[model samples]
Target: MTGTIYSLIPPLIMIILVLLTRKVTLSLGVGIIIGALFIHEFNVMDSIQQIWSAFYGIFVAEGGPNMGTFYLLFFLIFLGMLTAFMSASGGTRAFGEWAITKIQTKKGAQLLPFFLGIIIFIDDYFNSLAIGQVARPLTDRHKISRAKLAYLIDSTSAPVAVLSPISSWGAFIIGTIGAIIAEHNLSNFQPLESFVRMIPMNIYAIIAIFLVFLVVIFKLNLGAMRKHEQRAEETGELVDPNRNDIPGELKEEFVQTNSGRIYHLTIPIVVLIISTIAAMVITGRNNVEENATLLTIFENTNVNLSLFIGGLIAVYHSAIFYLIQMQPKTSTFLVLREGIKSMLPAIYILILAWVIGTIIENLGTGDYLALVVERSQLSPSYLPVIVFIVCGIMAFATGTSWGTFGIMLPIVGQIAVNSDVNMLLASLAAVLAGSVFGDHCSPISDTSILSSTGAGSNHIDHVLTQIPYAVIAAIITIIGYVVLGITGMVWITLILSLVLLFATALILNKLTQS
Candidate 1:
């Protein structure tokens, strides 16, 4: 059943169930079970065993505990505790109070994450989580919906990282491009040079980033996002109160004091940002060969471990600050417990997302999609647009942008080399753009999950609310890719895509308001 039509059923079922029921866990569980059954030829016993193996494999790989998974999970736990500490110690309150005075409007509050997301272009995971922590207080103070905050964080993080040459995503992409170039004997192109060329060609990323600014500046609240924003504005409910499992949400039992200084919030975050970047460089240097370029160092960097180290430092700083600002009758360990509790919902969703992703990989859903593209036998001029759509579908179904990139980039490279070498960079850029777009919209994407967790938004709410905006950007990107494919003009395609996105946003805003 591998790489066949049967492999598509599980993800399709999962996506449809998510749309209908809005139960992420249930949908992922069903998808996992169905995928397992297919893999085992519907033998119940074998299917059950396979499912167990899949779950176990998350924590145990290669005859040992998977330290990478452990690091990332623990990082989330630490981040949750950090959020709790800031709230319990009144850091969040102080920050919110101060922000209200400084940032007088919702638009200004919303733009905090927009700018921060672009500035923190180290890694998408780090950018999403860190920006959420820093901007949530201000956004909440201005009554900004969590869904909108998540959109701002998500839409910028990947786009900025994908375009920056010094980022973690950039390093990995450059390395992959190097391999592809080496294989294809493209001696005229340097990996870094080729990546720079693809920057303008990555239409989805540019258009998506541009749309974030338009949404913030123009208040283009579309689809479910408008409901969330309207509810927040009219009723002061930033999230869906019916959804109790939102991560990073402060519980009522936590103690908050009035004695907190602005530094209580600012210092720990500064420490986190500085420590994480330092750790990334240090860890990256240790793993790279002598005299390796900066990109190579980042390519070899231990991102999960660096994030864990930074989280540990931030938590330690927060704990110290919490003790100093501790009100009477409050226990430090109790605060820690509540903090861990706040993040457990997100952790569970992340684990399930990983499980379903694994099952889908085993079922060969992505491979089937890639194979379909390979066999399409399309004309050269249509390759970029076709690749963009198929890559989007694979990333959407699999909920892993990097996995989609790994699968599609090489295949797209081969297809381009054999058919239209002139269209290679444009085709490759489409893969990057489409992967990010699909990942942005996927319910089960780790980036999406983390963005929701960071903003204290319900995971499904984030997915549902973000889809319309992402789809609009994707549509504009498709048009750009078609133009690029036909004419191979990067500047014209980019300018046209931006114009279309801006016009769409303005039209949507007027229609929604009217």
Candidate 2:
């Protein structure tokens, strides 16, 4: 079979395996086995050689296979632990206690998770774990389901990252997009500014974020979510409010604790947000965090370090000083250890994901795809939509957004220069939309796994549940891109797509209910 055939086989097999078993690691491992088989001429000796060669290619790319997720996994794990620490230390409970105090109505309660998600865009990893940990109690207080909160947090994670320039996510995204300009040799191409402007035009991201807000504000109905809103309206407890009486630091503090104390929950989170911005400035990332030339304290700091620092500070200030009970105990240290330990499985998966990406690169999969794209000489007008779908497919297959970008950026540059493509915007749109799309729905995606695990939903449950919503949004985005190219009305495409998405989500919600 051809390289293209081989390239796609892995992801398809992986997807089928996931749909069957709902196990991400198992699916990915199976995907790897298929990939090795295809490349190795279906011989055992050849398969081993192909896998080894594939692994070798990862190191040559200046981004080793593990390079993509090493830092991210580290940040996510510790970030989880920090959230656990805060929860265990009474910090999260303290915040929840306070948030529930102001809520005389169910409406305010639903809106709180939305608010928390919006604020946490400072860092997606921070946003994911932090919001999940902090808001769980508040949502629980308001009769919110874990699924609802997970949806809010997951929805917020990417949209905020999509919009915010100063985030851990921006670096990879901005980097890939900028490469298009360099590859196309576009004269006077302003990489950073171009990327910023394209965000509004990136329809899937803009719409998904908007849909979440609508869900909260207008109460646009969604699956199993209506039950939650009704319950909260009646009683300020979860749908199944009876505590299982599980003993430990996690108790019903939201109803018991005062509202003034609830605002304390917002403090470390607020500081983390402020500090994140401050860190960008402090570190010299400038306001446009990804491609900035600014220099300072964080100039040399990797994103994971920044996450750790921000998390430490958020826990110390928000939980330690403000939410303290009795006295600071040694258990806080234990929680950190436990949190780090919790991340070990994810860490291993990250390494394997990278390794597979490396193997794929060894087969020259990305380069081959780039070559195919370049030689096809696709029209500039369709580039944005094409890029979005193509990159989405690649990411869906590989389960690594960075790997998808790594392969696509240079190739996109080649196309932009060779053709009329707005290399910067088109490339930017492709990488951002593709990465987010992949992470949003891919079974093997690390973020997807964590979101499900953290929210207590089965991994496949999350994937199966979310795919319809994600696909609908993607369809709207395609229309948005086409309209953008024809009319040159960027904002029109942006706002209209958001509207369409909300309507579609509403429809999906109604469908899911039926």
Candidate 3:
């Protein structure tokens, strides 16, 4: 069952339908039904029952284990509420006005999100949602397309999170590495040290982050993204024309009072950032020694609960600010309602994504993919490249980088330790890099979905426009891994890869213009 090719059918069907119909929800539904049928041996009634059971289990029956899903839903709702409060109180408008005075160019508008994404490297989910919410108003004012904004938010998120030493992603990777070390009985293994060593070797993340700057600095937009930028610039329509029911667009004009100050927006956001970090430190205190390091604190922190507390604090702060400004309590309630309402579509998409990811996991998608890689007969020198490609495909199909890491890391670790293939570190780096790269490109990925939700961008447009850029980075990353595998020269390979990426971007920009 592990290596069965049949396991690929569901994701393939979903991807095809998404590309053809441009309907993510419908595509996921169909994929789920099809997966159910496969799991039940194609018995229609049994498949229907299984699908229903899965829905119930994910949404209701499995409560404690599924707290993460609930946390995300609450986070999104409160985020929407925060956005609405900011907008209705004129905080968003005031901030946009202030930003326009300082930044007065499209590049600045795009670069702001890039820098914010890098700064909020604690978690990709937090990074995507917060950056998108903050930058949407500025990007729209400057006529930068939502798709481009989503690309920036998404590109910065997992890349920065994966690279940061004291972040949720770093902790997760370290844990997985530690498990692999224990399982394989590998001697002298230092998880944190190994992860730090792998940072320079994470070619995809390095290139992805660099590409954001290159695209922003040079205004490089190709394919669907170019058309989107053109439409936004020429017509002042920052939203996708095909889908005009953008979440926050309708509420953009409804300011409760003209007395909104920039502090109204800045204060809550600052509180959110501070509260989240503090909560993380406090929660992890019991788990660590008195002289705990920052990394140790992050490793022991409960990210979901900390994020929930942060969101709650931000919401309360926003509400109090409105009251202090003499805004009616009724008006504040209405704004919160509107904010919650706007997130309904995103919430529905997220639920489906979770269900599908669950289905993929139950179907043993990652194990199947790993089995295929295990069976492949390749040279030892090519192991890193192969592992990278396999892990990327698994993450893209399953729409979860963390899940991919959990399933593939142990397998890859064992393979690397084999007598013939001594590539433990290289393979580990490849798995890490590939997981992030694939999640970056996956339409159904939670981070990707959150990016679109946060940017207030059309989900499919974000996926379509961002894929080409992700593919470009993946190509260069593959070359870098190949060079590393063969020459064992990490620094040299990285330099060459960086040069190649810049050249590729320059050439592609010229071709797009021509």
Clashing residue pairs in all predictions, respectively, total: 0, 4, 0
lDDT of 2 by residue, 1-514 (tens): 4366566666677789878875656766776777777666578888887777655654445554544244455556645555555555555666666667867445676576678777766556557666665566676766665556666767777767766665556655565556666665666766567768877876777777777776666555444455545654576544234422111123222222222344445666677666655654554443344654532223233555465556566656744642355543545555566556655555555455666665555555555555666667566777777778777776676666667766776666666566755444655575577667776777666566556445534445556656655676678888887777666677877877877777776676577557
lDDT of each: 0.90, 0.61, 0.85
Local accuracy of candidate 3 as per-residue lDDT tens digits, 1-514: 2237888888889999999988888999999988887777888998888777777776575444566567768878888888887777778889999999999988999999999998899988889888877788789899998889999999999999999878988988898888888887777778888898888888999999999999998778978999899999999877767885454344543455678899889998988889988988898776887888787788898887788888899989987777777754346667877888888878888888888887787788888889888888777778889999999999999999999888888888887888344578888889988998889878789889988888888888888999999999999999999999899898999999999989987887788768
Clashing pairs in 1: none
- Model 1 poorest ten-residue lDDT run: 324-333
**Could you estimate the TM-score for every candidate?**
0.99, 0.76, 0.96
RMSD of 3: 2.0
Candidate order by lDDT, highest to lowest?
1, 3, 2
Model 1 Cα displacement at 111 (Å)? 0.5
The prediction achieving the highest TM-score against the true structure is 1
lDDT of candidate model 2 versus the reference: 0.61
Model 2 is weakest, by summed lDDT over 10 consecutive residues, at: 245-254
lDDT of 3: 0.85
Top-lDDT structure, candidate number:
1
Candidate 2: misplaced stretches above 4 Å?
A: 42-77, 104-107, 171-185, 218-301, 312-352, 363-369, 421-428, 453-457, 502-514
Per-residue C-alpha lDDT of model 1 across residues 140-164, encoded as one tens digit per residue: 8889999899999989988899999
Deviation (Å) of 337 in candidate 3: 1.6
